[model samples]
Target: MNSSVITPIGKILNARDLGKLVRDLREKQGATQADLANFAQTGQRFIVDLEGGKATVRFDKVLQVLNILGVELTATRRK
Candidate 1:
């Protein structure tokens, strides 16, 4: 279960991009929104909003979901 995605920085330029990644990873693992929410200790509505790319989503929860989905986001200076 070592699935991952490698996209150029520009490809994921917004919350929507990040959400797509999360949704993809979640689906890849055959996980339902409820499953992810339970693992992240949050409500299923939170998962819905997170996966829907709602800009106001909580940062801490976003990190938690990413952690559970085995996704890591990094920051780097553009060339």
Candidate 2:
């Protein structure tokens, strides 16, 4: 996605925003938290925390999850 769309999410805690996005994507893809966790190579509990927006997850971890969900993060200057 473009940086403009991501900028608002970036301003907040990325974990929360990314978590919500992941949850939505997973649900849309008919994947469960456990399934996503396995795909992301993380614990299910972590996925729960992510989905709940209750953790300050690392950016790299968030990116990993997003990658697994086929969501790409991109940046571009806004004019």
Q: 33-65, model 2: which lDDT tens digit per residue?
A: 999999999889888988888667666877888
Cα lDDT over the full model 2: 0.78
Residues 1-79, candidate 1, lDDT per residue (tens digit)? Answer: 4345465434577788888888888999999999999998989999999889898999999999989987677787778
Question: For each predicted model, how many residue pairs clash, with residues at least 3 apart or on different chains?
Answer: 0, 0
**Residue 58, candidate 1: C-alpha displacement in angstroms:** 0.3
Please identify model 1 stretches exceeding 4 Å from their true place.
Answer: 1-10
- Residue 17 miss distance in model 1 (angstroms): 0.6
Worst 10 residues of 1 by lDDT: 1-10
Residue pairs with colliding backbones in model 2 are none
Q: Point to the candidate with the largest lDDT.
A: 1
* Per-model CA lDDT versus the true structure: 0.85, 0.78
Q: What's each prediction's TM-score?
A: 0.83, 0.71
